[model samples]
Target: MQDPVVEYINRHPNAGWKADMNSRFSNYTVGQFKHLLGVLPTPKNVIEDVPVRAYPKGLKLPKQFDARKAWPQCSSVQDILDQGHCGSCWAFGAAEALSDRFCIHYNVNVTLSENDLVACCGFQCGDGCEGGYPLAAWQYFISSGVVTAECDPYFDDAGCQHPGCEPLYPTPQCQKQCKDLNQNWVDSKRYSATAYRIASKPYDIMTEVFTNGPVEVSFSVFEDFAHYKSGVYKYIKGDYMGGHAVKLIGWGTSDDGVDYWLVANSWNRSWGEDGLFKIARGTNECGIEEDVVAGMPSTKNLVVDSAVAAEQRASW
Candidate 1:
């Protein structure tokens, strides 16, 4: 039997996105899919103390730019991270963006730990795992910097489990310390963003990505999005789930000439074109162009000597 979501997508004659029944999300109920989306709180104003670099103007930007291609050193580009059943996409998106920016800024590659933020960042960011806000996650980065994935690996449930199946995953708790899976502790000062900012306009978001690296973006996820395989996604028909966040890495036109923003998702590599999806650009389909947040890595954090010295002095 065809899933109702699949049938809805298949039946839509002019739907801009293609639907795939073979994907893992084919049988997910609307409620189950909606549960995966986390609520994003309103973005707080930018911190005035942090230095904000003005983006260069009058320079021609390429019609397309892929952060992965431009900075292959960033392993996050090739890797597809999974948030499992937890509604921690907010943390994942912001952490991934910061990871990319850290790499671009320092020319060093390292995966920042979303688990660190998801579990350690308290109510100020949002409820751990249950839901969170991307902007709040970035703000958390500014106040309490996060650690690397090597120090605090993701502890959420894996996506291979059936959609409705409960995997006995415990609620995440904030440790507020940097420790690896083996329980070895690392210096927290080595991995944390000094500041963050929100970019709403489409051009601003693009400029941030081109200049800094990927930026965290949130958008409304519809039921039909579960079946997205390829092509530029435009909302066709589906229940409106709450907002979901992802890392916006680049933008370009598809072979069919449809414009799209390339985004990295936290749903695992098995879903949505190897855990990456593209949505309609310019029109801000699903409010993607509206809520965008990014962060800058603290230069002091990038320097091992300074970071270690600061850690010793408990400065950060």
Candidate 2:
């Protein structure tokens, strides 16, 4: 029997979109799909307090812009990362955005630790792996700062290689200390964001990505998205799961001339187009254009000496 998800995809007419059944999520049940995406509800209070930056009056934006192609040095336009079976997309999205922004600001390409935020940002960000809020995660970055992936690498289901390291999934105890499975520790002060901002309007969000780099965005995910292979996705039909967060890198038009937003997901290279996907633009499909959040890296002088000195000593 054909999988219902696959059947649905096969039946749907292509309206500038296509779905593939060969991907990993083809057979996942609605319940299972929902479990994999763990974006928590937007705390009304936090959203209300988050300051919005308005684009300067009448500033014209180019018809198209892609951070990856435009600022290749700062963009981590690499393979899609696998979050395993854990619900750490929220942490990954926020951390990845900060990583790219830091590179853009300082010309250094360092993979910031998503595990650090997942296991240490505390309850304020959301329960590690189980779920989290992107905004709260960014706020955590500003206040507590996270370290590099070299300091604390990500290991969702494939338990850490280090002998004494405990697996962190479903839910793990928050440990602010930065250490690898090998027990070696890195100073938390080495890498951390100093400030962040919220961009609610579509233009403001676009400007942030154009001037800065990628920004973290959360949006509603439906069952149909699991089979997304290529083309601009526009919510054909399916059960609305919770929310999923990703990094919005840029925007462009498809060969058919459909406007789309370029986004990077954490589902690894096996899913989507090499771990990247494009959604319809302008109309805010899936509420992606809403609730965008971004942050600035700490000043070089603030932690450069400490970070460089530590890197020199440990070669991280």
List pairs with backbone clashes in candidate 2: 196-295
lDDT (CA) for every model shown? 0.73, 0.73
Residue 108 displacement (Å), model 2: 1.7
* lDDT of candidate 1 over 1-316, digit per residue (tens): 1367677776777776778864555556556566578765654543334444345466577889888899987786667788876778888888888777666666567788888777887777777767887767777777777777877778764563756667434456766555545443445433445445545566767777887788888898876787788778999876777889889889998888888899988887878788889898889898888777776676555554555445533532
What is the lDDT for 86 in model 2? 73
Query: For residues 210-271, could you state the per-residue lDDT of candidate 2 as single tens digits?
Result: 87678888899987788788889888767787899999988888888888899999887878
Q: List TM-score per model, in order.
A: 0.85, 0.84
Best by lDDT: 2
lDDT for 115 in candidate 2 is: 84
lDDT, residue 232, model 1: 83
Off by over 4 Å in 1: 43-57, 160-170, 177-186, 189-194, 304-316
Q: List where candidate 2 sits over 4 angstroms from the true fold.
A: 157-168, 180-186, 190-197, 300-316
